[model samples]
Target: MAGREGPRPGGRSARVQASVHGAVQALMTRMERAEITIPMIAVEAGVTPSTIYRRWGDIQELLADVAVERLKPDMQPVDTGNGGKDLLAWAEQYAEEMSSKPGREMIRDVLAAQDGGGAYQCCNFTKQQIDVIAARAAGRGEAFPEADAVMDRVVSPIMYRILFGEAPDTAHVARLVSGAMGLVSKAPASV
Candidate 1:
C-alpha cells in the first residue's frame, strides 16, 4: 500500500515520504493534533497538499501513516531477568504509552486507516515484541505464555479499553499481565 513509506523505498519517493513524515512529527510537538491540517503539513514538508492526498487519501489516513511509524517498537522489552517481571514491566509501559494523548491518537488513527495496513503493522509490532520476551524467557529456563495468548488475553483488553475512552490504570495492567501469565504451560521437568 502507498503509505508514508511510499511504493518505492529509494530515491525521490523515500525522500518525499521521510520529509513529509518528519514534517508531521515536527508539527505534533508544537501544536494540538486536531488543529493541524494537510495544507500546514504540506507547507512544512515542502510538498503540495495534493502529494499527501494522493498518497494517503485523507487526513486520517495520513495521521495513521505517521502514527504507525511512531508506534514501532524501538528496542526489545527491558530484560528483567525474570519472565513474569519482564512481561509485567513491558505491559505496564505499553498500557501507559497507549493510554497517553498521543498514543491514544495514534491507536485511533491506525484503526481508522482505510486499507487497515497500519492496524496490521501495529499488531505485528506488538506480537514481535511479545515473541521476543517469550523467547528470552524460554532461554532463561522460565515459562512464558505464547505470544498469541498474551495478545488475546492481555493486549486485546488493553486496546479495547484505550479505544473506548477507558485508559487502563497500572492495577488493570498488572491484572492483565498476571492473567496472561497463567496461560503459560510449564515445560516438562527434565528427567
Candidate 2:
C-alpha cells in the first residue's frame, strides 16, 4: 500500500531515506540561521510533518546529534612534543575558534537544546577530547585523573564568558593547563 510501514514496490525506501536526510539538513541550516520549527522544516523539506516526527522520534534528538557532529572536530587536541605547549596552543586555538560569531552562535543553539531538556551532546564531545589527551599522556608516563575538570576550567570559562557575556581572566587558562600537567606528573608509572 506504500504506507508508512510498508515499502513501495520501487526504490521508495532509498528515496524516503534521502528525503529525510535532505529535510534534516535543510532544517538544521534554518536552525543555524535562527529560524527553526517542525512545520517550517516540513514545508521546506516537502515532507509530511508526521514523517519527520516518526522517523526521528523528535526534533531534540535530531538536533542534538547534529550539534554533536558540528562540535567533533574542534575538540581534538594537537600534539606538540611538550604537553604544556601543546595544551596551551590547543586551548588558545579552541578559545579563538569558539569565540567567533558562528561558533558562539552554534554553542548557543546547542546549549538551548540542552537547557530545554534534551540530551547534552557537549559532554560526549568533551569526553572524546579528554580521552585522546589522556591516552597520549598515559603513553608518555603521565596521568590525568582530572582531565575533564581541567578541560572544564580551561575551556568552559571562555565559552561561558563568550556566550553569556561574563568576564573571565586569561590566567585561568594557564592555571588549568599547569594544574592538569601537575596532576599528570605526580602519577606513578607502570612497572
Candidate 3:
C-alpha cells in the first residue's frame, strides 16, 4: 500500500511520461554516436532497463522510432508556380539538414542496420515523408515520374556525402539539384 498513487497505473504520471520520452531521445542520440546497450541507457536516463523496454518494445524499435521522430522532411513539394525554384529550395534545405552532424549519424546508423531487412523496416517512416512530397507535387500538376526522379537525385548525393564525409558544398548541392531537374524535365509524362 505504501508509495501507491491514486488512479495512475505503474506509478506513472503525465509529467513522467514527458521525461521518459526525452530520455528515449537522448539515449538514441548516444546510440547513434556509439554502442548504447540498454543498461547503459537506463543508467544515464535514471530509469530502469525494464522501463525502456516496456516503452519501446525492443532496441531496434526504439532506434527506428527515434529516427522517425528526428527526420522532419519538408512536406512542401516543388510548386512555387515555377518548378525549378521549388526544386532548388528542396535541394538546399535537404542538403543542409542531412549534412549536419547528428542527422548524418542517425542516417548512417539506420542504413547500417538495413542489411537484415531492418533498413526497409525502418524506412516505412521515411516513405511517409516521400509521400508528402509526392502529394505536394501532384497537387501542383507535377508529374509523378518527374517528381520521383528529381527527389531521388537530390537525396542520393546528400546521403553519399553524409556517409563518406565527402564535401557537399553549395556548388555540389546546386549541381545535383540541376541534374535532377534536367532528368525530371526529360522524363516521360506518365510512368
Candidate 4:
C-alpha cells in the first residue's frame, strides 16, 4: 500500500502520523528515549518500517515531532493588565513545565540526539511562547519584552539549572522572571 503520490489531506497519511505519534508517547512511558527504535514504533503503530523511514527519516525526527505535539506549554499567555506580571506568570509556568519529569526527559532525549549527530529539529518552543506574550503585551499598549532578552534572562537560566543538577523552585523562578522583566522594561521598544 505504498503507491500513493504526495500527502493527501485527511487521509491515510494523517492516520499514520497519528498512530506513530501515539506509539511514540506510549513507548516513552515504558522505555528510555534512546532505547526506542523505529522498528518497535512501527510494530506499535501498525505501520511498516519503510513507511516510518520514508515519512520521518529517523527516530530523532519522529521524537521531535512527538515532543512538539505533547511537551508544549498547556496554558495561553495570561493578560492581567500588567506586562511584567503577565510575563512573570508565563515564565514561571514555562520554567515549571521545563523542570517537570517528562520535560526533563524530553530535553535529555532531544539534546542527546542532537549531540549524537542526529537531526533533531524542533524550534525553541519557549521562544514561541514568549512571542505570544509579547504580542499580547503590545496589543494591550504595554511594553513588549524582547524575545532574546527573555530567553537569555529567564528561559536560559531555568533550563540550565534543570538540565544540570538543581531545578529552580517557584520562588527562584519568580526572581528569574522579575530580573528578566527589569531588563526588558529598561530597553527601548523595538522599531
Candidate 5:
C-alpha cells in the first residue's frame, strides 16, 4: 500500500477495491475480527488472495483501508442558520461519533497500518467536513476561520481528548468551538 494511490476512477482496479472492501465489511459483521483472513476476503470478493496482497500489502493494511473508507462522510454537516451554531453543532456531533465504541475501534485499525496512508485519509475526512462548514458560513456572509486553524484550535483538542484522557463532554466541545470561532472573526472566508 506504500506506493499505491488508490483505485482508478473506473476500471478493474476500482471494481477490485470495491469488491474487496465490501467483502471485508461483510465479513466483519458476520465473524470475529480474528477469524478474518486474506483467503476469506478473496473468496468473498471472488478475487484471488494475491489480488488482495498486491493491492493492500497485508491484512492489516487492507482492514485499515476499509476502515478509512467506512469513515468517510456521506453527507455534509448540519446547517443551523448561524456559522457559530453550525460549528458548535458539527463539533458536538464529531465528538459523539469519535468517542463511540465503533469509532475507537476504527481509529485503532487505521493506526495499526504501518504505511500511515489510512491515517492521512481519515484526517482528510475531518478536514473536508470543516471545509464544508467554512464554505457554508462564507456563503451566508459570515466570517469563519480557515479550515487548518479550525483543525488546530478545535479538532486537535477534541481528538486528543477522544484518543487520550476522558472523552470531552458537550460543554468542553462548546468551549473549543467557541474559541475557534472567536480566534478568527475577521479571518479569510472559506476553506
Candidate 6:
C-alpha cells in the first residue's frame, strides 16, 4: 500500500494522525483508559504498533495528544459586545461539557496520565481557550479578564467538583460565572 512503501510525507502523516486520533476517541467511548493498549489502537487505526511507538512512545503520550486535540474549545470567540456576558457563556459551556459522561472520562484519563508528566501539558488547552476569550474581549473594547483569575474562579471550581464526585449544574455554573465576572470587574487595571 501507499503508506507501506515508507512515510508518505505530509498528507499521509496527517492521515495517520487523524486515524489514530479517531481510534483513540472511539476506544474511549467504549473502553476504560486503563484497558486501552497501544496494540489495540494501532489495530483500530490500521497502523503498525511500531508506527504508534515511533510517533508517541506510549499510550500515555498518545492519550495526552488525543485529549488535547479533542478538548480544544471552538476557536470562534463569543462576541456579545459585553465581555462579562461572553466570558460567562464560554465558562458555562465549558462547565457543561466537563460535567458530561464523555467529558468526565476524558478528564479522568488525562489526569491519570499526568503522573507520567506528559498529560499535565494538556492543561494548556484551557490556557489557549482563555486566550481566545481574552482576545475577543479586547476586540470588543471591554476589559479582558485575567486568565489566572478565570481559571481560579471559574474552571478550578468546576474541575474540583468534578474530581470530587459532584458535577456542577447549570445554576451552579451560572453562579461561578457571575463570581468570575465580579472578580474581573474589581480587578486592578494592571491585571
| lDDT string, candidate 4, 1-191, tens digits | 12325446788889998999999999988997778999999999999999998876677767766766676556678877777788888777777777888887777656645333221233455677788888877876667658898888888888889988788888998888788777655554565
Pick by lDDT: 3 or 4, better one: 4
Please, what is the TM-score per model? 0.91, 0.65, 0.62, 0.78, 0.89, 0.77
User: In model 4, which regions exceed 4 Å deviation?
Assistant: 1-10, 30-35, 73-75, 114-124, 184-191
Index of the highest-TM-score prediction: 1
Give the TM-score comparing model 4 with the true structure, all chains together.
Answer: 0.78
Judged by whole-model lDDT over C-alpha atoms, candidate 3 comes out at: 0.60
lDDT of each: 0.88, 0.61, 0.60, 0.75, 0.88, 0.76
For model 3, what is the error of residue 52's alpha carbon versus the real structure, in angstroms, after optimal superposition? 3.0
lDDT of 1 by residue, 1-191 (tens): 45455567699888888999999999989998889999999999999999888878888988998999999989989998988899999999999999998898898888887889899999999999999898888887787888889999889999999888688899988999999887766663243
Error of 2 at 47 (Å): 2.4
User: What is the lDDT for 122 in model 4?
Assistant: 35
| lDDT, model 4, position 42 | 96
After superposing all C-alphas onto the true structure, candidate 2 shows an RMSD in angstroms of: 6.1
Q: On TM-score, who's better, 4 or 5?
A: 5
Backbone clash total, candidate 1: 0
> Which tens-of-lDDT digit does each residue in 82-130 have in candidate 5?
7789889999998898889878778889999999988998899999999
Q: Which residue pairs overlap in candidate 1's backbone?
A: none
Candidate 4 has which clashing residue pairs, if any? none
**lDDT digits (tens) for residues 1-191 of candidate 3:** 11323325545644444455567677665655357776776776678888766665556555554555566454554555545566666667667777787676657555644233345543444445556656666676665434456547766667677678775888888888677766545543453
Query: At residue 9, what lDDT does model 3 achieve?
Result: 55
Model 2 global lDDT (CA atoms, 0 to 1): 0.61
**Tens digit per residue, CA lDDT, model 2, 20-42:** 55676776655654467666767
